[model samples]
Target: MTRQGQGFVRHIELDSRVGTDRYPFSLPVVTHLAGMGRLDLDPGVTFLVGDNGSGKSTLVEALATAAGFNAEGGSRSFRFASRSSESDLGDHLTLCWNRRPRTGFFLRAESFYNVATEIERLDEGSGELLRAYGGRSLHERSHGQSFLDLVYHRFGPNGLYMLDEPEAALSVQGCLAMMVRFRELLRQGCQFVVATHSPILLAMPGARILQIETGGTIEQVEYEQAEPVALTRAFVNHPERFLDRMFADDA
Candidate 1:
């Protein structure tokens, strides 16, 4: 289970001189990175957890782009762009690689439809490309099913995967399934960088959880300390209490 020296990317660094007046650079998390110099990555799985706009997704997207995956979400070979909403932060980000991945994927939940469309286009004339993705167009499957298909069929050993809010389309059961797949892939020498809000996904054993604070600080935290886990536990344990607090004014 020792993952030392097994990851493709060792760390990521930001250029100190990168401009700070832009959309992403102005973001608190990005500003933190500008001063932090470098962020070291775990060799197995690294989970970025935070509230909305904390810059977890933005960081994951920038990492994927800097690592050569398409900004719209797909493999390195995928070159189609539906639109250009991605920030230019990737250009200023630098990855330190221990070894290059033989295969890889960037999966952004918001833009997966475009990735599927690109897959269908590539599968034109022949089904070779489609076969690699569960032998069916991702569009033909339900959202969660398609995500699972990609994890089970397209992803392989010794690959690098970056995911942003993968739980957006998945149910609780699906999240458990993804966790199982992630463990299997990790044992097969794959590495993952994920930005997620799901408490279930955050419980992956041995995964490094980096919690992004509101002030733009990223700190490694235990499963018990992760905000998603702690908050979910509180809500689940005493729903009435939380509900009462929310409606206290009315009472």
Candidate 2:
């Protein structure tokens, strides 16, 4: 039987006139999709596949904010959480998720600094928080440790989580552990939207892969057929040959 719509944000209307300058802090936008008008987002696991600076992060940030997640809480833009806005868009977008997330988490690879700061803010009133985060202050724990803890404790069934480049701090084993968690969450009807370069994460079966090209257009493709996955696979399978070709080209 066919499935029904799950109330995920299937479509979004983006206007170029709605500039980020009003947001005060502007994210790096290497690709411009302002002309796309209305773009469709898939309801299930979505892989925003693209090269660095392709504006995947920017688009995801905007969409997450539009979906009403707390910017600093892993689901919204980090900058938005630090600043206050009276704008209707921000207010209205937040209302969408007021009911509670369906199931998911947003992981930003480069925003660990903000995450650290957020933990500190949470510890302000609580004295001696070192014991709370694995017997060390959130700041005292290593970056990887903190990240692993976030995944372990924060991930739950029926939550809509968005992750941005989650592989930045994880080791091979950590990634594998994450894959296990992902499967568990998926089984519980949790949906994930991840922007990542990690082949392991991309290998999650049945994920809907969407490539956001540097040109700002988004396209759906297979994980194995993706440029990132293919290039990564080739290098891993034949690193010596790949390196030789690279050096040969330099020669």
Candidate 3:
């Protein structure tokens, strides 16, 4: 399915007026955005790849918050917060929307338990809200199982999704399954912006991979050039070589 012009988000622009002395602003990727006028989003899927502390999750969370989803993680309507640890960057981020999504969700692996608790709270009275999520509390299922259920049962066509490190809970096979489901959603006119490290998820066909360099540069890289894919491929093809180098350093 060609998702050429059906995406809700056209791009994201950072306000230059935002201060550079803050937490997220001090981050590399955020600094990059401050200088770079705007970041264009792919219509189908856009994958943000970077090492830990590179600000990928911070960016994704800000996008979700700027787009009206809860900062912790959940749909736009979910207004509960377990604790406020989100950065102030969301307030300075602006989304340019070509179209509006019919449905949407923000899934952050670290705060998913809080989102699940919010879900249970919303489902207290009638259980009707839980029905959308496969008629069970997300907390009842394993982490990976709950994620799969959200993808299969709650997510629908023409939706906008923002995910941060979804592979944190998913096994290798589960990542593969997520890729399959992601394709189905793409075909149904869904758009996704994911911050992830899984080579498996990053390998989704037609997805654009944006790599954030240590110096705060965001470059669009091909599948072979993506750090996770390249490293995984090299390690899998010759584990002994990498192991030898590591052990040699200690020797």
C-alpha local distance difference test of each model: 0.92, 0.63, 0.91
Give one clash count per candidate, in the order shown.
0, 13, 0
lDDT of 1: 0.92
Q: lDDT order of candidates, best first?
A: 1, 3, 2
Residue 127 deviation, candidate 3, in Å? 2.4
Model 1 residue runs over 4 Å out of place are: 2-5
Question: Which residue runs does candidate 2 get wrong by more than 4 Å?
Answer: 1-7, 16-37, 70-105, 125-136, 249-251
The better-scoring model by TM-score among 1 and 3 is: 1
Candidate 3: residue 44 Cα off by (Å): 0.6
lDDT over C-alpha atoms for residue 198 of model 2:
78
Q: Best candidate, lDDT-wise?
A: 1
Q: Could you tell me which residue pairs clash in candidate 1?
A: none
What are the candidates' C-alpha RMSDs? Answer: 1.3, 5.1, 1.4
In candidate 3, what are the lDDT values of residues 119-181, reduced to their tens digit?
888888588999999888998899999999999899999899999998899899999998888
Over 55-74, each residue of candidate 1 has an lDDT whose tens digit, in order, gives 98889989999999999899
Count: clashes, candidate 1? 0
Worst 10 residues of 2 by lDDT: 90-99
| C-alpha positional error of residue 191 in candidate 2 after TM-score superposition, expressed in Å | 2.3
